[model samples]
Target: MSNQATPWSSAMPEAQFQLMHDILAAPSPIGLEAAMTEGVLRPHFERIAPDGWGVKTFKGHAGIVLDTHPGRDDLFTVMVIGHADKIRMQVRSIGSDGKVWINSDSFLPTTLLGHEVSIFSEAPEAPGEYRRLDGGTVEALGAIHFADPKLRAGEKGVRKEQLYVELQIHGSDKKKQVEALGIRPGDSIIMNRPIRHGFSPDTFYGAYLDNGLGCFVAAEAARLVAEAEGARNIRMLFAAATYEEIGRFGSRVLVGEMRPDAIIGVDVNHDYVAAPGIGEKRMAPVEMGKGFTMSVGAIVSEQLNRRIETVAKDKGIPMQRDVVGADTGTDGMAGVLGNVDCAATSVGMPIRNMHTISESGCTRDVLACTHAVAETLLAMDAEESQTGALHEAFCSQHPRLDQARPMGHQGLPESD
Candidate 1:
């Protein structure tokens, strides 16, 4: 039965969530280009860019749906730059006193496997003193924790607990230094913490779940929709984009080209840290183990929001709402101005000590967003007319959310 008809019988289900979790558990964030191409995404993703320099593209079966203009084409393509590559670990616990810890409670977010982790030298001169270890504790989706204390004199403030790991690098003998023959750029840093699950039901603690969790939701939903074949008119495009933190450029290109009727960009939303004045209402309120969060404000479109809300209400999809004053800091910007009828929202995970090293989130929350997105895909029109909504939302949020700074173009050629 269709999700609408039976309500309880949508293609995306609880079991699917578990399956998705395992897939996300795979090491290395995105499917390798060679594999994704020679293996799976080949049929759908069209490689439009020149190869080499870690760049690849894929042109797919479906295109983006343009924003309401009544007269648009079916070119709505949702480009997703996910974390299938790169690992930013926070294993080394640095005390507020600015002391370093290689073994203590410090932790870095890392992928699982015999994957190599990077650590610098204990160069006596700087960073207090810390170096890499041959082997240490880096559990899947986890890292070590340390005790926070003043390592020496004149150190006041401190971050309580921290963990760290060592990373060895191989460089040219001619170019090697003490810290050299160590870690280098583009090294795949794995976490020292192992992922653990409590006896508790449906709970998990792991690393890389930050975006991996998000990817799980998106991929599985696509799998389910394909199986059910509920609606033929709806064409689902699952884009595994890369280089988001690098500059959010991958999706930028997709939005420009795809031009979907409307887009629901699935991404991780920052959790609310109990700051002095920031109440739950003001900042996003995505508590772990809850459902997903919906973004509001400039980046997210009004009409797009309405559509998502409509779907949620129609189905039993659980969601929370967040209001963004200036920029949602999401892929929302691309959807709006990139020439598409788009509703930008997020399925967020409540991450703790984000960007430091090892990030945290609830597995349940991840699953919910995935399911919600899948339902959205099936429900989205293979070809929906962009009813000028993109332009309208742009006008409203443009002045306020000056998110994307203009990339000054090469001016007209000088006169002869």
Candidate 2:
């Protein structure tokens, strides 16, 4: 951690970026592995299985589970859900002839090339930078193409359907464009921020930290937990769930597996910024550069919150507090609804630009969450052991213990 942000902080690792780019490139209109890979016919095979991990699939779902704690295998099953799906990359119109005409929809075009449009709609936030696309988020039913009086095709004229949607990454040019960039549709388009490894990058950039950074912290922490002494037989799952952005589909399937008694979800929180309708209440401005923020509410059990707080305090980890009157719309939501009465909660890092590619994050924020979660897992040994003891005690108290004699008694008609 240097005073200056390190390259790692801003730079995406080859593997991370490749995996990210690949997944982001998928035609993941909604949790796309493959329409062909869905239930019924496909001979679905497990993709990634490590030693000591169980592999299973039911319906159109695939999952992995690790059972530690020997016989008390049923003690608690926790799930870590991270979205792996998103909206379909589509184009509504193509720009052309000094000005590319656009179908009145901004949503579709913006999703496609607006970010990569290589053109401008209006004055940019700063000089030389083009403003966000027109219609903001509206979908472009079609586009107006221009046969630049220069180069290859020699200016071919076409209609909306043939021209407009044809250039989109997920619409028409989806396959070709994605292949050109080695990307695909249904693949979640990550905010493509250049990760830097260092310090003092931003004082604020909160909320929408969501699961991306959360997943990273979990991954690093899981690695440490796995190799630590007295290694917490915690059987941690660093699930990088897909499709949360679309509809929380990843969380849906994951919750079915973990059913953890409680969970500490890692996401983002609103920064100390202001905007209409997004007041302090809806988007509490938890200060950035301070540390991690913890969510509190019925959804987040007091005991669990306090326990995490206690861990933070003891470890000197940085943290803040937030009130939740409604669902946080995170993997924690799924965790709360799962089989076990899980205490759902979240830890956040500072993130700016929310859903935009211009999103920024603090290394300190990510590190703080990692420390908090790692410590929480480390601190759970005693709690889990205590829970195991209580369970054993309960099981030993079977009321009809003496009611049924040995099976031999029933088998032999009482010789006496």
Candidate 3:
């Protein structure tokens, strides 16, 4: 709201930017997010968490939660979640010609063509051990000359079923050769693209920005909240969830288990203004480098949203209102789907080309989200210190239609 630039609008710290790059570089495709959860998120959390803070891991998955003021029944609990899973392809089968058939999960066939990928295959003999197979490219109808006239002319679209990984292993027993390398039918495959700065300032482009950006934002916010000085009457749960690309199962599980008083799901959103082929369908004019995004519909809690907006406005942090109709399409719905009675909402940074190999986002937006979330949590703590009943305060602050005053007509007075 101020003409002058806010502190968060500027470039983030060099170490923080490096942490973002590290998070995006680590591969954590759906059903296999341990590489991200244990390798990147856990270490980051441990490094920043205060002495009293603790970490909680789920039973059978890589989902993790960092807790502040744990096991405190007298304090209000807020769970901020960011899922760690990235959309990925799975090995469906292998051909004798060395072509590896794959199932494209949440990706269009056209965007995947010629993109390099790394296949993460678990060893058959050593079930827990894994091998990374590089130097493979996703392909379909190899070479423009081999395609049908209709397909080449754009009359037909290439289907995911027809896509395969061309490993270029030449042998009569190509299937046997591939099997010998421990590439099984269920191995996960992910893009090998690393995060890189875009042409513009504070912009970055890369693969798996969908949820890694979310996790990064959440981690940074947790660090900020932990460092803030306050009475700290609220219990903060910063969760890095898994399996969100599939169905948001990991966040739902965490929500059900923790059953917090409120939840804020952090994830990436589309920059609809710059997105291609979104003809005639009305969408929020969200853009990258503008600010972070806040959900305005679905299961979003009005009181919680107002709290976040107040913090952003007071801090001069920019944010855009995102309209999500039936569902937020993020982990914000975890509490709802888990049947937990709690206030919930989503916050995100807008990016271009979501779900593609070359997704783009702005560091300014990421920092804005981080600041907004951290400031909001600190604000809640301050309010709780004064009110002594944080949960009741939020629950009682919903907008009331009866208290609304009619707006005065500015047009010429109606003639009687």
- Per-candidate TM-scores read 0.58, 0.58, 0.96
Which run of 10 residues does model 3 get worst, by summed lDDT? 1-10
Q: Write the per-residue lDDT of candidate 1 for residues 1-416, one digit (tens) a residue.
A: 12343322322345554444444444442222222223333332223111210223446311121111122244343333333322344334332332223332223322222344444333445543444444433332132233224423325432323333322223443233323334332223344343445344545555555455544554555555555553244323455544444444545666666555445666666667433354455566655555567777766656556656777667766677866777656555655545555556544555554443345555556656666665655555432333423334434643344675778788999999
Give me the candidate number with maximum TM-score.
3
Ranking by TM-score: 3, 2, 1
lDDT of each: 0.45, 0.47, 0.89
The sequence of per-residue lDDT tens digits that candidate 3 reaches over residues 50-143 is: 8888889988789999898767756789989999898999999998888999999899889999999999999899988988989999999899
How far out, in Å, is residue 160 in model 3? 0.9
Candidate 2 vs candidate 3: which has greater TM-score?
3
Count backbone clashes in candidate 3. Answer: 0
For model 3, state the Cα shift of residue 210 in Å: 0.8
